[model samples]
Target: MTGRTGLEAVRIQHVLPYDPRQPGGVQTHTYALSRALSDVGHDSTIFAPSRPLRVSLGGTRADLALHPLDALALRRFLRLPHDLLHIQEPLLPAVGPLALLHPSPVPTVVTLHSAEVVAHRFYRWTAPLTRRLMRRADALICASPISHQTAVPAISYEPRIIYPCLDLAAFSAVTRNPEPNTILFVGRDEPRKGLTLLLRAIRQLPQAKLVIAGPVRHSTRQLADGRTTFLGPIPHEEIPLLMKSATCAAFPASGGEALGLVLIESMAAGVPLVASDIPGYRIATNNGDAALLSPPNDPDALAQNLLRLLDDAQLRERLANRGREAANRFDSHVIARQHLDLYQSLVPA
Candidate 1:
């Protein structure tokens, strides 16, 4: 079979460490990338644990848990047939490391996803093992320059930087009907996610109504009032509508991000953004060009940026236009083509 580019189609096996049911960046990337590859006339299958149910996207679910038995299941799956094996977050335990360590039947490409992995003491202790596992990969790719830099110290090799892909067509199709003074925040309920800071910032904006998405912790739930609405753990298909309904989106993560996918999603939806000024977010926003940036963990600064967007409709319009333009670079088709080119290079024509 040949793809649209007139090259022989390649069969790719994507290995994700986390469960697809839990909404996160890496899981979303795997689903979007696989769908994109399929759209471009390639065979892409995802292999991951089946916690409650398998992902709706075409793939086989394994009953393997995070134990030694996972290697046995992976060994059996590897024998099924594939031209290339793409493992996400190879430094993670159990499946990711096991797959990288074990001999593979095909060329392997490993994507490093976390920027904070190197800072952990566990990574330091297992640096030698991680380095050996990484050497087995035929190609190494990082989702962002921040991830590339973080991997160099541990792996002793530079990885090619590729921005994470998004379904731009879906977001672009969404109708923009921004609610007046409406602010949206999407992420887990972790402290590093800066939901606390966003809550504090909302306190200063009396007229602003905040919408919280994803899992909200019990402690954070108590803080929600009549002004806040929590739509917890929405389906991926509903994200475009959620993004379109917002006046502006806010991502206030204090740290621990490789590249914020929400920033790209917000931009693709043509919603104005006010995100943290961190290394990961800076890469996503093109150094604060596409969105308003404020110092991380500073509620006062975050509030000021949100206020500016709320008060001035002209500024919001300008940022929304710039954001849509910036999001074009990370379109799914473009990123899928890059991956296909890499796979073609590794495999035969």
Candidate 2:
């Protein structure tokens, strides 16, 4: 199990059921984990949908050929020399059950990234299936306390809490922007993500501008006041500079995040945060020590918090410095070592 250099270099196979063209926290987390494993002298390969990707967000890419549950695919995966099969966001109906049945021979670890799958209107029918899958996992990894709470009732075993890892070195390389007054928001425009609420809050502040990164699904009336700028689908490498240049970062997601990677990235860049007081964010920030909390779904509270951070330079600096320190806990090397330890525990002594 140990390499010649006295290090554990186990091979890991990460299974992702989601599309690569649509980038989100889960995609970012998978890619970061792969890179982190490599840094630790371990090998990681991703099994994702077989599609022509429009954009390349480079990690170790391999194809699952959209048949993750097929008998041939299952056998193929089970036969691999990989020590562990890590199923990211294992709530998908197709992939979750595969761990329970044919591939039961392999030691498997399942990471549950969101609680939404249990409550989504379309996925409600799959509740029983999801619970069974959760119980079948050899070792379960919850991305945050909220995610752990959601998985606890469904499974008989205790789930280990591992915060998603971040590439802090990349963010540290970027120089912090001087005289930053721009509030940064990164994520798709969705009801659950609170994009509308963010725009409404922007209307209340005349002295601040909000930089909306990522794709927007809903069209909005022209708020040509020059207070908000939409930069669609920003490159992943450029995100550190964007966070570094931010006066403060805002993520007002109302609910359903296992762990907010954007919040972690902002914290890593030493940028102050104004996030919704949801369980996911609350657990990540250690009960609001790392960031300011505004009540969810209330545009006025969001606006007030934004104004408070924008108007007070001393408050922003204090929160930013604390956030940077807190972000160290989620660094790539630290998280990778924790995961390697977990993988070691699952194997025979």
Candidate 3:
């Protein structure tokens, strides 16, 4: 694939187990990276299920709709024409085993983005098969150090660390003045995400209003009073504006977060952060330098941190400015080149 000065333009296919129509970090990352590659003269396509709700993360939609794993679907995926096969979530039994059963005709790359706890539980039954498939990949990537640690024991080769990248310029160009006392919370209402704790914290700070931007699943706690408003699944394109309008972005995940993509968006938008002190959040925010760290599952600590950011103007500005500068390292162009270089390395020298 190497040319005189750089690698020649080639087609790449990304296989995803879930639908991109739903709002998710992995889907958003895959779509954004595909757009970045297109800007650099490379063609990228996604193979995922076609849900009724069609959505695009500011890029081309999935080229082909993948079906449930079976002999038919497996054969269909194997016949696609491409220079490389990129698997987003590598441990899914439905699609991952195909890479091992019949090795792809071209190079294959796998990216692992889950925490150790979740990955272990999901792959416990088919550990050996998953390990073998991971080993067979030409390149392995983990989005964070915690992800790398979680995936190392499954494969023989060391995985490269690549943080999830975003279009920082888009978020930076947004010039909307933030609304005071408006705290934005994104992501689904999972137990690990600490939405319950956030509600309790909000109760302590009666003056602040919390704007929830995602779907809530099985959250019986009703806090939709005058203090909370649920926007109900904001589009991927509008996330930058939502971030820019918030006084502070909160991701109070108690556990099981590999890399908080919302934290990156908050930083890129120059919005101060209030995240839980979990390993994934620590690695994502550089050990609390970029965000205000609160104890996991503690409403009092979360409330205190939120109040601190809301109370002090200098502290918010300082953290926001630092986060903006730190976000440049995870820009879309920088990460696209990294993947391009890795793809070129897999070919013969």
Error of 2 at 237 (Å): 1.3
Please state the error at residue 329 of candidate 3 in Å.
1.8
Per-residue C-alpha lDDT of model 1 across residues 224-329, encoded as one tens digit per residue: 7789999998887888999888999999998778888888888989999999999998888877899999999999999999999999999999999999888888
CA lDDT of each candidate?
A: 0.83, 0.74, 0.77
Per-residue lDDT of 1-349 in model 3, one digit per residue for the tens? Answer: 4333256886888877556777667777888888888887787887666532233321222223333444356567668878888888766544555644565678888898776465655455566866776777888898888777666557677789888777777787767588999999988776778887898889889779999988775443465568788888888788888887899988888877788877887788899999999998887677789999999999999999999999998999999988887777777888888988887777543
List TM-score per model, in order: 0.93, 0.86, 0.89
- For 1-349, candidate 2 gives per-residue lDDT tens digits of 4543257677788877656555666677777888888865777887666542333111212223245345356557657777778888776444445644654555789887664534343334555666666666788888877776655545556788888887878776657783456899988666678888888888888888888888775464253357778888888788887886789889999887777788888888888999999888886676789999999999999999999999899999899888888878888778877888888788654
Ordering by lDDT: 1, 3, 2
Deviating ranges (above 4 Å) for candidate 1: 52-70, 117-120
Most TM-score-accurate candidate: 1
Q: Tell me how candidate 2 scores on lDDT.
A: 0.74
lDDT accuracy of residue 274 in candidate 1 = 97
All candidates in order of TM-score, best leading: 1, 3, 2
1 or 2: which has the higher TM-score? Answer: 1
